[model samples]
Target chain A: MKTVIRSTTLADKLLFIALTTAAVAGIFYSREAMPKGSDVIIEVDGRTAYTLALDTDRVLSVPGPYGNTVVEIKGGRVRVKEAHCPNRLCEKQGWITRGAIVCLPNHIVISVGGKTENLPKGLDAVTG
Target chain B: MKAVKVLTVLLLLTATAVSCSNGPVEYRKTKPLMDTIVTITVVSESDRKADEAIESAFSVISRFSDKIDFFKHTSELSAVNRNAGIAAVTVSPETLGVIERALYIAKISGGAFDPTIGPEIRMWDFAKKVRPSDEEIRKNLPLVNYRDIVVDRSRSTVFLRKRGMLMDLGGIAKGYAADLALADLKKEGIAAGIVAAAGDIRAFGLKPGGEAWRVGIMNPRQKSKADELIATARLSNKAVSTSGDYERYFIENGRRYHHILDPKTGYPAAGCRSVTVISDDGIFADGFTTAVFVLGPEKGMRLVRDCGADALIIDRDGGVHTTPGLKKMVAFENGH
Candidate 1:
């Protein structure tokens, strides 16, 4: 009777150890599974002008108040190729795989990722 | 009996782990409004409640935008501009409140940030990539005086004493909208959040895990590198505003002319690459940034000191000046 009881306790302890390990692994996996953005959104004058896949390679001409701003996407990166805005600040913004390129004068903005994921974690908003 | 006790302990551990993993989540949303992107972020246990709170905040921002948008012909501000020098226009209480705050700043800044500078601002052609001739700027300078504005508190009316005197509200409107959005969020029982309109930002309460919000000040010289930070500040229940020559400007004959025009000279204010102000009031911070940028470092720091606000001013020569209080709060980035 004593041997039977000891064997049952050992079996239950093994099961408990397995369950705890699985639960800890599950928690880590969920955290790593957070979704990453696969698209880039371009807005002109506060309106969506284009939504391109990050895997695609293309050049897009977006018209704005100043003139046409040429945007290029290559190697999963997007940037302003050229701009008619006086400062050419948009063109100076070389390339972005993440984050945003904002041409305030042209009223153009290129954002990486989906709409909800545009802002990075821990940042509520960026001011200036 | 030992087996049963081990099973009970395992179940309790699992429960604790799951509960800790399901801690409060951060919800954030950004929408383009009022000529800039407005982002609101909140911490809540329920996603549905967070969505509702953000929506409420955005609605408040939209309402304020409608009241003060100068580009929109149907806006109450446009109505006021249309009736300038002809009749006193009755504005909404909110509009009156913003205008009143603007006038007060103008008074304190001594016309460094004048709302009636609209006529002068319209003279510059940033879209056309051209600078207005000095003669044209001179012709419109007389129309940019804040003293010419007349306000009737009882009637909530505003009038410009001279013809072509326009009220832009560009300097302070974003801050006012941010203030309103924060109030709306608080009303909706949001314990902590941030309301940011362009460069005007107001943070309230504490972030999840009791951490203060971290804000990065952009490197004004390196406009192309949007991720480059000149410095970072940790904030809670405060407002920060930055005015820089890089925002809107045209380079002509090797001169960079920006949008923050001086009311006295009718030209872009120079001497500082950027000016950042922090205070409890968003409107005051916004107005002071423009005012201090025009004032340069010495006088600007003096104004900041007098106003009892913290400031960081970057000069055209690549020097960084900070108030004693700000020196404690900011961490300068590499190569700053």
Candidate 2:
């Protein structure tokens, strides 16, 4: 059987090329805007409850086994604002820009996550 | 047109390529145990399976911690300390094994990392910023002899010959717990993972894409948060640990007093700022870091070579030193 085909116009080719280029550029642009600093992740009882940008200053009351673990983020740093755990070790940790702040009695873990530009392999752990 | 069709196909292909980079999702859980945050990361096909493996790993670490906790009144180590100078205290095989390793390190390190430094450690409360009196340190120094502790491997009993002598496995127990956690992960059939308990890290197998786990050594004198790491090392089926003066310390009169004490002086080891040891066994790496810190760079490197382990030492002046083996494995951040 003979096949019938429609010929493409220059305008149609230009439109298709422009759209593809724009789509590819958009993807790359989004990747660049991912995260310059990091994100504060709050986990309660083995599940994530909040993932907020570190640049934003906010106070979050995350509920856990015992009570709310008050978390504060400011100036790209995170801390345990308040916790009901008897030891208050988390509060004593003060401000941390990386790693984690854990309130064991509350079953809460606050960690920093995002792309660290220089570390291409990504840090599995930090030993001190 | 045909050109449009070709471009559409190319667009689909690009999207697929972009999304495929994220091969397998990782399941990670962090909990506070053994005086630090213990994070277990597993790359698994199913979330439920990963979660089970992680929980089992955590349970294994928790149980091991209970057996060796120096502060916990009911722990086996506590029982042994309670029976010091009295009689041999019976312990589990696991406890005996850890104690044996501690003793071995103590012998090799020439008692620099003695398990009997417990009496001195208890005197200085880092949290309260309290320092013990000179008299107290001098008194406890004599009791800090690793030779005083006797172990009976046949019967799994440990004895301290001195009345006030205390055996604190804090230096080495966490690494052993991390090693156990990794074993649990393997037993659960998790392909690749890392068990990190603060400064003690045990990594095994390649990641989902056959890449090794990368660990950063925290700079002892980090100027900023972004400049946390002095070096990074790629590890697979290995353990890397760091003992840093920065971890626990208090500054008084422009001098820093840290927790890692030299058994000879009953004071903080001042030769090095931090010592990072990499070894096939987590317990060895963890204990060696403390030993090396107290031994200084020249002597520490000798001990590292004798034990067939690698070390990265940051001296009191913030100078970087590494053994030949570690120099080949680690990538320095500042081109050291």
Candidate 3:
């Protein structure tokens, strides 16, 4: 019983250490990981910027640089998919899937959101 | 006995776990751009899918056009403009809401924030026209009266019984728009964020790591560098708007012509350079700031303090004053 308890504690310690290491590693990796191809350059009120893969556009929106300056692509139209900013003006802005996503108030520009990656997909989120 | 101890340990662990949140709920980016004389900060993050929301929020509030401005045109207010003689004619929900808030400010300012000063604003040539003669000013003076405009919230309409009466919401629209945008961000799954329209700024939730969003208060006198910063405000959802004479003004015979007009004499208020109000709604903040500017600092501070909102005031002499909340949350970078 004593040996079993010791082994259990050892396993718990190892798991905690692994999780801590993975969390730090993930942050560093995400900061450095580069897309294999061109990214869409989003221009904001002028400067504050962000970079995202095409897949991230639907879930994340950074508006000027104010409100949900959202842009969505649908039916050959690039529209502001949704926003709570009165009147859903971002929804009226229409879409841009390729180049830059501009949120003037937030100053977030996704210079790359929707480009295909020719590089092999090795490190899925789980692997990280 | 052993089972009870184990249960107690489990309860403690559960309590600790419950206290820890998932992560920092928001992110932001600030820059020095807007008027070139001041710095603009914008932060963004998502609690949901479908990005690109900020772009849509800003253009609507920031755009300056005669058309599509909720302030300039609402069905009820339009009807009032057409009816010059009625003491109070019926209006709509949008107009009624705006006018009702305008009256609140008007009463608070002791008549400084009047929505009926539309003709006076026109006479100044700040938004439209070049200028008006003294006769033109006097002729329209009688039309400016918040008392003449009544609101029936239950009926959902505003009535202007007087002729030539127009309610201009330019004072509050930007702040209101900013408030709307911030709300929109939260609705779209922004756990933490900040939104501003030129001067109307609103922040919410937590920083990306649960830290507060630090907002730098620009020095109105210097116009370069924010002399103060308001940090540690835990308000996840609120709007901050400042009205200053710096933006639009003209020189005529060595005097400045600012946009905010007092309904009494139909001219700019005597003192104060800027008045900033922070609240949960941009519309209230926007209009209150303008009205406060017209009302001057002493009363402005009282109104802000009474409403439990925060405010920063820069007097005409370049003196900076703040309400209790501003003094607590704001740090003066250079003797502010």
Candidate 4:
């Protein structure tokens, strides 16, 4: 069956599609400015070495060379669940969002969406 | 037009928050040149780039991997070993810097931290291993005066007064690199990270989880195991370095000859098996770690304190002597 469409309506539809695409692209490219309120917790080898909560402006640091891992907390899952460093794998594994973050080598994991990662990686481990 | 303006404003805000980005970026780096397996984690937002920059810097300063390292050559020191007695020779900038730091440590240790022990080290032959004659030791003893070896920073010059004198910075260079990397990371927009070069390390900043960097001081006696958790520090914009003899030493005729040699006597300093130096500057830790090995804990502690540096000395008897402000960092139950 043939469908009749108005020329003016078609032009409006095209403009709407273009505007929608531009808005989505703009948001995706400039995402860092989107006020990411999510936080994270780092567990190395099943040990909670860091409990990071991200909100405003902050940077963090923590030790490394960990392997073998276990993560806790719900909602935001901790990755890097296993490694070789006597359950100290959290240091070796990678970061984790509510979605994913894990390091197979060190079994390090950063849990996301569960807690706030306000501190840097190494602030709590060292005295400086 | 309003939406466009908002997007531009947001872009500017992210740019302003470049160093302020606390996004947990796991840092994993490896380098074959320094013979190190290094892994660093930072909230720099781009942990991948941080690792790349550090590795790149190591390549830039590597003496073992590049031809440019010849500029910082210790060949003159080797030349002294070849020519038992000659007038002082000029040295390169890199050599001069290492020697100057060694001399500084020497003065701090009050002769205990001498750098002119090159001849003595050659006699003992810990690096290669072939003991020299007693006559050779006597001859070299006169040559091992750190005070005699002079360095002129302005002119970038060094002179071995007694001729056969040599200066080795095996203690401090690695520490310097670690400090440099941490500093470099900050300069390169990585305000949070750590650098461990052959066990000489330093860390700065906190984890995204609001915790400090927990460095594990491996057991000198046991490679695979940690002796005890000597310390877990915040590194809060600081550097650290650890020197030990359990791995790099020679057991000759029931005697163990380690690399940490005293400049005055040409022998390994007695009193400690390992010395862990924690300082704001990696270079100081490097020079002081060896200085402590030469100076012993009492004088070493004094020298380190005078220099505004900190230390953790694991004594020959397996005791730990931590600095005044470092006692809290030393977790002996889980440290090396």
Candidate 5:
């Protein structure tokens, strides 16, 4: 009986140590694996029309009902380089490292960062 | 002793597993409607349910937009305009409700927000940067009056008293649409969501982790990236609408002419740069923002307080005025 009790104690301690290690590993893995500011996502008419890497330098021409809106991404920043809409307010918005640039007339949304469960930091929506 | 130790570990492990299974997943869908992008975000337990709810909400909003579009010749509001002084035009229940609400706001604001400003609005072309002559404004000013609108609730019809008077619902329709979409979402079993149409936004229920939705107000004079947001408000079960001169305007000879016309002057209101109103209902928030913009900061804040709503007004000289209840919720970017 004494020998059996010692072995049972050993098994319980082993199980406890194993579970603690697994929990710690999961926490580290989730933290490291999550991507931040991964890509520039441009949506046209409610669809993901373009997903460009933030590290690359590229200019994309997005077509809308009105005309094509030119988007330029460079040096970890993005902006609407030119727009065919009459207001040209999208072009005047300039560059942004985070948040979204919306062209209401053309129905285009250019945003930075990966889509997460929480709303984007600082700005979930902008009202003017 | 061994059983107790093993049971403790099993309980902790079960708790973590249960939490992971019940974690909320967010779904978002955006579409172009009412001349702006309408985005609906909902948190649900399953993707299929969220997709169906979002689709239904969008359909509801689309149907509402078709009825009240100011530019569409076949819209119900246009039908009422065409029949002005000729006869009453029967409209949908949704249209009647929105028109009734518009008249209420018009009365309370003392005609600062008149639905009959369509004739005056047509005079100025913001896209062409054309400023109408003072004589043209004077000719149209007489047609811009809220008293001219007549709604017969029993007959379910709308009539304008004057032959040339036109009813434009551009100010209040978007917010009403947002409210309708949210109601549809709730009917579909969505407990938490946000519906945003341009400057009109409505939020209900808590976000993930029980956090209130954070909404940022755009700076009227945003010259660069750093000045994007003037302030932010944490809101739940509330609606917010903002009217700004910078939204649709043209500058000629250092004079600015915006889309939100004053009924009395038949020209862009010059009192405030922007006005943001928060209320329990989206219709009031939307309609009152335009009314408050025309009323300026002092009178606007007073009217907002009277309506049991909150507001943040930015005057022409870059001064900020906020209602008492909203002072703590609004966090100014520059700590103003």
Candidate 6:
């Protein structure tokens, strides 16, 4: 009876180690596959005008109701380089790695990391 | 005995695998609507359901936009403006509902948040960078009174008592849109998500992992940096709106002029850099931000307390004043 009890205890210890190792490995792999900043999306008058890669550096002129607003993406960040709107609020809103740059008068919006899936889980939307 | 031990190990491994894959998946989409960016986020186990909810929410927003967009001549709001003082223009029930709410807030705020400030807004021409002459402003100031707006609930029509009294629903329209979008989502059986229109946001139900949604307030001083947050608030099942002087402003001759006008003075309201209000309704949150902003800190705090809402007002001197209830919910960022 003593020998049987010792064998059962040994089996329990081995099972515990095997389960924990597998769980840790699974968690590590999932974390490594998490999404990052991949795309920059620009919308004009609520319609998507551009979807470009973040790693690319370029400038594009987006025409709006008021006039043309220049959008610049550089070094994985995006911003409004110039705009014809009087206040220049969009241009003043500097580089954004995440979140959005909204030019209300011109009806243009530039969002970094286009989809919400690429962003963290807890943040649903940004408010002023 | 050996076979039973191996079975127990397999069962434990399978349980761990299930637990690891059980985290909620978040889905979000941004569409340009109502002259601003509208973002909707949903967390659920089913991707198909999230997509359906977002589609319905956007449709609701589009329907409201078609009714209230002041700039769009085809919109119902344009019809009302064109017939100002000539006749009562028939409108949809949605437009009637928003106008009624706007008038109610205008009465409560003593006309500080007037939807009839369209004539004045057009004169400023923020897009064109032109400031209207003082004479032009003086002539248009009298037309900026909310008391002049007449709403006929029985007929579902709206009328401006005076000619040239334009109804610009910029102040209150987004809130109404957010509220409607949230309602649409709920009807579609999506209980965990947020519907946000720029500065106006409405969050409902729990976030993933059963945590409250964390909302970051942008620092007015950090105008150039979009990610520089002044404070953060944890909330669930509520709406928040912020009106800041820094949002749309131009500097001329060392004087900074902003877009939020004081219906009384016909100039940009002073005393606060930004005012954020959180409440159960988006319309209230959006309208009150402008009202509290025009009222300044002392009067604003009084109104906030009376409404049973939470507020965080940043004065021009960079001092943060929050209501007692908001004090617990807000955590200031470093240097704030």
TM-score of each: 0.78, 0.83, 0.58, 0.60, 0.77, 0.80
Worst 10 residues of 1 chain B by lDDT: B221-230
Number of the top TM-score candidate: 2
Off by over 4 Å in 5: A1-122, B1-21
Find the 10 residues in a row with the least total lDDT in model 3 chain B: B31-40
DockQ of 4: 0.05
Instruction: Considering the two chains of model 3, state its CAPRI-style docking category.
Output: incorrect
Off by over 4 Å in 4: A1-128, B1-22, B34-43, B63-95, B125-130, B223-234, B252-254, B334-336
* Candidate 3 Cα outliers beyond 4 Å, as residue runs: A1-128, B1-76, B84-92, B126-129, B223-235
Per-residue accuracy of model 4 over B1-336 as CA lDDT, tens digit each: 334444446656775687466666656443433322233444555656766767665654454222212113345545433433454445565566566666777777777766566567645544334567768767778877777766667766556665555655555566666655565667667766666564566777765666566654534554321222345554556667666665346678888767676656566667787788778877777777777877777777887887877788878877778788776555554434
lDDT of 1 by residue, A1-128 (tens): 46644667666767767767786788788765654445788987778888888779999899888889999999877878889986565575456555567777788888774245544333455455
- In order of DockQ, best first, we have 2, 6, 5, 1, 4, 3
The TM-score-based order of candidates, best leading, equals: 2, 6, 1, 5, 4, 3
- Of the true interface contacts, each candidate retains a share of 0.35, 0.55, 0.00, 0.08, 0.37, 0.39
In terms of docking quality, model 6 is acceptable
TM-score of 3: 0.58
Candidate 1 DockQ vs. native:
0.25
DockQ of every predicted complex: 0.25, 0.39, 0.04, 0.05, 0.26, 0.30
lDDT of 3 by residue, B1-336 (tens): 333334446655775676554643333322222211111223443423323445444443333222214333444455566665664555544445556777887887777888778877755544222567879888989888888876777776566767667776667654555565565555655555666444466676655555565544434554321222322233456666767675455557877677667789887776788876777776777777877787788877777788777877888888777786666655555455
For candidate 6, report its TM-score: 0.80
Candidate 1 matches the true fold with a TM-score of 0.78
The sequence of per-residue lDDT tens digits that candidate 6 reaches over residues A26-101 is: 7778876766546788877777788888889999999887788988889877878888886565776556665678
- Runs off by more than 4 Å, candidate 6: A1-40, A43-59, A63-109, A112-122, B1-20, B223-227
**Residue-by-residue lDDT tens digits, candidate 5, B1-336:** 565366556767886887677767668876767765677889898889999999999999888888997766789998999998899999999999999999999999999988899999877666457778999999888888899899999999999988988898989998999899999999999999888886699999988778887888878887655566789988889999999887667788999878888899988989999999989999999999999999989899999999999999999998999998888667888844
Whole-model lDDT values for every prediction: 0.81, 0.83, 0.54, 0.56, 0.83, 0.81
lDDT ranking from best to worst? 2, 5, 6, 1, 4, 3
Clashing pairs in 1: none
